[model samples]
Target: MENTKRKIIIVGGGITGLSAAFYTKKYFDERQIPIELTVIEKSPSFGGKIRTLLREDFIIERGPESFLARKMPIMTLVKELGLEDELTATNPQARTNYIVHKGKLHKMPPGLMLGIPTQLTPFMKTGLISPLGKIRAAMDLWLPKKKGMEDESLGHFIQRRLGKEVLDRITEPLLGGIYAGDTHSLSLQATFPHFSAMEKTHRSLIVGMLANKQKPAPSIAGLPEIAQKSMFLTFRNGMTTLVDRLLKELQTEHLITEQGVQTIVQEDGGYTVHLDNGQQIQADGLIMALPTQQTAKLLPNRSSIQWLERINYVSVANIALAFDEKEFTYPLDGSGFVIPRKEGRLLTACTWSSSKWLHTAPKGKVLLRCYVGRGGAEEWVQLSDEQLITAVLQELKEIMGIEAQPIFHEVTRLERSMPQYPVKHVEELRKVRADLAIHSPGVYLCGAGYEGVGIPDCIQQGKVAAEQLAAYLEL
Candidate 1:
């Protein structure tokens, strides 16, 4: 008699890990393959950056608030998980956003898409840019495209075509906020290759964007009315609702939490996972969903995957301050505002949560979501909680004239949460994956640190990893 059951383990219970586990089991079940699957998380929670807090009538997201409606991967996953009905979109009417210039907030121009000016009237009439800056930006219409496909900095690309004013006043604040990185060192090829393609196709960023604007959007027929009309979507309850649903789909007995993987030992043509809690598990296949830095630590022979350790991360913090309706002086007229690094302010950006998402607060209540720290200047993230809150409040007072104390507040500090993509990032990652295939045959790596950093990207990476693992096991 011979043992026949195969064991597969996924380290890290974040979206990537859960997705890998779910898809792997689904694949195995469809083929009637007998295998044992386990998911382990270091934290006592499942969703790594998707936690929600419910206090009284307010629902606050501690991690990612929502996903873009256009990200079809997440949309498909939501539908497959029977959560389509739970999807909700941003408030349709509260669409205005702002950018801080010289300590004052200026409404974002109407036809600005991702910091590129598409409409002429609004760009010319807007006071956000000086006359010289506006004139420089208009030169993009006649600027020559770069000569080659060589990689460049996002800052350099924007500066070269439209000028530095647009990069500082518009793109740096809006786009830089996403990666929490300085545009000067950020890679254009790895982070936003589409911009380069846009230039190639139209010879002008503005002209390319104008063409994009004229093109009719794809048919989103049969999607929920809210999802069809909105650019972003999330569950009515919160983003963590997806995490909760994924939990129910998995085997409860195999979902291990509060324990992390210590080291991995190779034996018997398979692997042994040693847990930090002084336990061991044997597995024929493994999926490493942890960050690249953590993954490098577990591998015995790390000479090949040394690049993993080179991938860098930046720390940041988000604070949600609540106020009584009458006590809050600033009108919640817009979605929020972003502050450019040149402004030299402690606050990076602020989101009027109550206005942006109607479900975030009760009627007559206000919720303001403020962010601190950026890639170039993130030392403030290590400040004490009280000190941090005080600094944010002071800035808010000057920025929004909110001198009143918040009725309640919640602060979340994420250390090394955002990954930075350097030049030639895609090629570097490809080389590492090939090295992994040759060195660790049965192990797979998929997470934000590898391919992409968005929620949909992580989920897709997980599903792809599962497919590769199943094939490796010849299932």
Candidate 2:
């Protein structure tokens, strides 16, 4: 145990880096191993994308609003950090989501799971589909399972199983809203393999969902009540609460803000990290908890960078507007709305934040958060704050019929935030791991790049990286 003392340096102060620091501290502290930890963050603040904006009486999230609690690591961390009471669920009534078709908002029909209709009545009534389109969708019930193929695009799978209407109207918008990705390029194996398995097993997605309707839901510990009620959750304050709590629990010396790593050079039996501000730190182990592109920059000669560079990212802007509830003709109901690419709207998705959680806004006030720009839509990303707000306001006027101006408005841009999971994503990840093993040693990578993209996924990757590092150090 005395020999287990090792200095560790973690790059990036996002949730992944923070989680790694916290878990590593716990492991070493319990084992009586003397460990020194340091976390370097590029931004002045530590939360990274998990930023919460408080203006007047309204609480706005600059980045991700919530996490899907179905993943265990996030929930476990929340409990470990004592944030259980601060967590809240989305409004129960807001469980339903709306989709834009042609030029109007239509309720996404119930019983559909990720664009695959598990029930018949809802699919038949969903106005997004034409009568003939509904018939093509229903034909999936009798159609045989797709024969063996290595992999297929989400676009191709949905078009073959449920028809182009479902892919274009529902699945595309829902998935695109989440991933900000094109269905034509998204891989079913990497994105949503459960649907693929359903097709292979029951020969029909509807039959599989129906047959499993009575099965008990999967367990997710330490999730907020709303998460137990459903699968997703957000804090009443914002996603930043999770990061704040983790930072509070960990030692201050282990964390550093506004210090970005400029480069990494191997030296002696360890490594030396050069900082952008002309400083260097030596560490027995290093964890690069950054996006793939940033990691590529630090490892110029590594082949892993080529594959990491091939994995592209999309920029996004989340515009939050606060308005009086009396101004809206239609009551702000449901979670929010998603715009299908076919609708040709400048925005991607909008969330009724005030409705999604309690205490998000003042009395009689409503907060609407609109997400815009993805893939090739750099025009929206480049828009001035005023221009972006005006564009979103005009769209809201036509879609939700809100005519009044917002009393308060805020805009947040996430440049290259979402990683594109193309059809070759799996191959790229595999190559990355193989290349890293052959080249970089005593160095590891984690975050939304190689694995899942959700908050929980990041936490899980961080914890796994910590365990692997601990094992390598034999701590």
Candidate 3:
């Protein structure tokens, strides 16, 4: 008997891989395509970095905390999984974001969005920037926009257009903390092309942002309240809720975890994936939803994909400490504070989970998620648990003046987690995609390494890859 179903294997069962499987199955069903889906995960768990800890009445996230709340692809999947009711917005009361400057926490101005100022008054009044710095930043309005569209470093762009002061104090830390990257090397095009677009269109980043802010935003009208309230949102219980629901939707029949792929070889106009457990699977098509370098390693052809190997990664760690309200006396009204690279602090950023997410902690308990390690300063990620905790605690004490100990703490070390996008990343990736399309017709790549790093971004990438795979299979 001849089997008619096409064997489509999805490697790496993280959010991106899972999303790909989910969408592939959906698209196949919609198009009436005979498809058999399989998902392989090297880790013991399905959700790659999205680990959530539930202890007592606290919900702590070890990996990513929340994602941007916008009309992105994650919203559609959430609604499909019946998770719209579980969405949780950040606490409205905790509105401020502080920056560590001169060993003191300074409140970031109100009108700053992602460290770029939209309002002049608030930026000029900010304590984090000096009067001279503010004056330099104001020069952006008069500074002529760079003529060429050639790719440049984010640090260079910010410092060139605004000033070195804003880059060091605000934008660098705010954006750097997102990728655990040093903004100086991050590709302006690959990381945030919108910034470049603003410069090209308006000639002044500040004036452009101000104009964009002033434009009347489209009415939300009747969207869910949580979606309307804040720019970021997560599940009420934790981030794992999304993964759990995805598992239920996809079912465990197709998932294979705790199994690593030893190698992938082309066979019979398709592919044969060899697993570490001495098992082989035939695939008519493959959705390689893994790291860029890892995907390149598995492909048959060598030279074309070598550029992907150039993409670098950085290690990071996070410490989550739980405390009874009495133990945390210092006023932590804001969500948290970001430490600039110039501060020479091991800790990069700290999130007041209890204060930020009202649902994360019970009435009298507080949870703090402290970030550790970033580019050029990531050696501490390899520190022993005791040593790391002691050092972080001492720093927290010096910064916030809190002597009380946490009831309990958990540390998560994520090695090689953050993908670095150096200058020319966008163009390089485009060429690689073209090479894959020409050299390896049935193979595709999608994950944090290629386009985006956020959870929602990963989901979108998965959806896109699945759509492309579906189109290829139909052909």
Cα lDDT, all candidates: 0.88, 0.82, 0.89
Clash number for each model: 0, 0, 0
Q: Compose the digit string of candidate 2's lDDT tens values, residues 1-475.
A: 3575698999988989899888888888787888889899989988778899889889888988888766678878888888878777767777878898877889988887766787788888879999999999888889999988577888888888888988889888888667788878777888888888888889987788777775787565444565577567778777888887888877555677787888898878688999988998888888889998888888747665677877788888898989887875567678888998888889888888888765789888888899898666667756788888888899988887778999888888898888878886777777776676556666788988778888888898889888888887773
Candidate 1: clashing residue pairs, number: 0
- Worst window of 10 by summed lDDT in candidate 1: 219-228
If both were scored by lDDT, which would come out higher, candidate 1 or candidate 2?
1
The residue pairs found clashing in candidate 2 are none
What is the TM-score of candidate 3? Answer: 0.97
Candidate 3 Cα lDDT to native: 0.89
TM-score of each: 0.96, 0.95, 0.97
**Model 1 TM-score (2 dp):** 0.96
Per-residue CA lDDT of model 1 for 233-254, tens digit only, reads 8788998999999899995539
| TM-score, prediction 2 | 0.95
Candidate 2 colliding pairs, count: 0
In terms of lDDT, which candidate is strongest? 3
Can you tell me which runs of candidate 3 are displaced by over 4 Å? Answer: 1-3, 220-223
Span of ten consecutive residues with least summed lDDT in model 2: 218-227
